[model samples]
Target: MSIYIDPAVALSLRGYEMPERLGFGTAMAPVMFRAVCQDGCWSNGELIPYEPLSVDPAAKVLHYAQSCFEGMKAYRTGEGIALFRPEKNAERMAYSAKRLCMPPVPESLFLDGVRTVAAYCANLVPGNSGESLYLRPFLIGTQADLTVSASTSYEFYVIASPSEAYHSGNMRLWVEREDARAAVGGTGDAKVGGNYAGSLLSIGRLKERGYDQSLWLNPADRSSVDELSGMNFFAVIDGALHTPALNGSILEGITRFSLIDLARNLGYKVVEGTIHIDELLGQVASGTCTEAFACGTAAIISPISVIGDDGGSYKLSQVPGPVAQHLRQALLDIQEGRVEDHFNWMLSVETVEV
Candidate 1:
């Protein structure tokens, strides 16, 4: 499929200036990539000016909630603009789309959308450490009928934000037991809009209690650890790196996988298995679990200082454990091109002269 670059897109990029403060995915890039699908046939993609979308009131997304998205970043590495493991994002998005009965976006098309947006907005990517152009690719059901079924038509878009890292300091987590974000046989593993929508209320409730995030528990048994709203949970137990096993319900995080590989290379034992919440809290209290953290594309590696449950709270022995600090730095070094790309994970982009 051919991609059309609109001339107006260049003008918008030229006139745009990024703001100084970028807190997560708030700021929008001047241009965006768009494409549409109708009755299983996809239209040629286009680079267009970023604008508010117009949708019919009875769109399928509004009723059936068929939507999925991906979160990635474009970095200003010394080798020019580079994307980290974009193919993983593409594969994950396909998995997410399939879970919702939507057409899986072809890998080539997904790469094209992200590359087009990142290449045009290359100049706007922040140069500071832990800063980059945050890329968000999403697809929504657009069929203008109010039936409780998957839409026959869909709209895909790639929006961008120049932002700083999500969480830089230590994060205090609340052990969520009363409410579950995703269910046992539901869309828990998929990066769907509904999963996040379900988690917002829990996050809001935790914020009121002065907590930074919620460490969700497994939906089935409610005794094992699952993950956070948008990140995967991890901890250092007995000087080894430990994370909750992907039990058919945890969203597989890119950073979580990368850290697992990097930690092993750095001589740390990495374990992926079920972790009982009560046992973990007990270990934290006894100093066997030295540190705990969350990992994702958004919140790189936020060390957890405290974990509060219904009965009491357990504090980790180390806020930013030695393992967490070392692994975070190692991952960031490779991402920002400060260190060698030993894993060949970085994909260099050819700048499109607009």
Candidate 2:
């Protein structure tokens, strides 16, 4: 299907100015790609000027929270411009939609939506080393009736933001024990908006406590580390890479998977299994766990300096350990096209002529 580009999109691009500081998903691009689905068939996509969406007051999404989204990036590469592991995001988005009982966005449509947006906004992609165009693809239930059922009509959109690395410095994490973000068999593993909404209060309370993020534990046990609100958790324990296993409750982050493979290739022992919360805290307190960090498409890798719980606070011996630094740079090198992509992860985008 052909993509329609509204004339206003061109005008907005011509008149737009990028801000000097892009602190991760703050400054949105002026154009957007949209497509709709009805009765299980998807319509042709269109590129138009960015604006607020119009929805009925009783739409199912407003009540049932039936929405899913993906975060990926477009980087300036040796081949002009490329996306890092976009297929992974597409696959994950489909999984999220299915878990929410929404129609899955076919992989082809997902790629077309993101590539169309990125090709047109190539000039808006930041040139800085840790900066690029962050792409957000989302699907929502639009049916007007709000009777606690999945919407028959759905909408898919790809919006973009010019962004730099998410966090500027080492992070402080608050260990949440009182409230559970996701259940064992719930939407915790899915990239749905409701899971994020449930985490906002934890993040809000921690922000006042001088913490940068919340390290959520598994919902079933509440004794094993799951992940952060928007990222996956990792730690360097005893000269090995330790990350939570892909439990049903942990969102399988693209960056987290890639780093595991990257670290293993770099002669590091990477382990993915259950990590007891108390045992991890004990290790951190005893200098057995030297470093802890989080990764996602938004924040590549953010070092965690402290983990605070009701019992007490434990500090990592190295906020940004040598292992994290090495892996981060290695991953960045592959992402920014500074090094060879031996894993065939980067997909080059053909600039579409308007």
Candidate 3:
């Protein structure tokens, strides 16, 4: 389906200036892509000026938390603007919407929303390494009713940001023992707002203690490693890569999945299994676990420096170990067009003329 470009969208794009400080996801693009749905029928998407949404006070999303979102990037690759594994994000967003009882944006519509935004905002795709156009595609229940049920109306919007790499540095993590980010059979696996809103308390508490993130344990057992608050976790033990196996509660990240495949191709022994927190800490102490890191779309891969709990802090011997450095460089090389895309991951977008 052809995307409609509003006249105001061209003006917004032409008048806007790229900020000198391109902090990650802070500087928004002047134009956005939007599509609406009512009674399970979706409208054609539009490229329009980015503006504040006039949501009703009694909207279902405002009260019942009926919202979901996906994060992906548009890169300045060898073949112009490209999106990395966007289909995975589209699939995940569909799952998230279904979990919240919201109408899933059709894959075609999802691709149109992202591709149109990326194509129009092609000039805003930063040229620097570790920088790209960060695309945030979200869905919200728009029906203005206070009743505790799914809304008949929904709005989907895709906004872009010219961003530098999200740099968390070598992170310090706090083991969250008191609070759980998501429940066993709840919306834990979904990429919904409530899951993140529920985690802010734990993040704030950990930040007070000088930790950068929370290493969340499994909600059911609370003994095995699950993931970080926003990113997936990985640890290298005895020269092997180990990430927690995806259960019902873990949000499967696209970056994590890509790295697993990339690491295996690089001849690393990749293991996806239940990683017990106690055993992991013990391995860290014994020098078997030499390095650890977290992966996500925003941060890419951030090395973990320390893990602190009520017991004590366990520091990984290597801050940014060889495995992490190798994987990060390999992934970035593919993303930035520095090397061949052997896995056929990137989908190039033609720049749309104003």
Number of the top lDDT candidate: 3
Descending-TM-score candidate ranking: 3, 1, 2
Per-residue lDDT over 199-279 for candidate 1, one digit per residue giving the tens place of the 0 to 100 score: 899999999998999999999999999999989999888888889999878999999999999999999899999999999
* Clash count, predicted structure 1: 0
Each prediction's TM-score versus the true structure: 0.98, 0.98, 0.98
Off by over 4 Å in 3: none
Clash numbers, per candidate? 0, 0, 0
Better of 2 and 3 by lDDT: 3
Ranking by lDDT: 3, 2, 1
Against the correct fold, how does model 1 do in TM-score? 0.98
Off by over 4 Å in 2: 352-354
lDDT of 2 by residue, 1-354 (tens): 788889888888887799987888889999999999998999989999999999999988999998999999999976788999999999999999999999999888899999999998988988888799999999999999858778899999999999998885799999999889998789888999999999999999999988888989999888899999999999999989999999888999999999999998999999999999999999999999999999988889988899998888899999688887898889989999999999999999887544
Return the lDDT, model 2, position 228.
Answer: 92
| Candidate 1 deviant stretches above 4 angstroms | none
The worst-scoring run of ten residues by lDDT in candidate 1 lies at 16-25
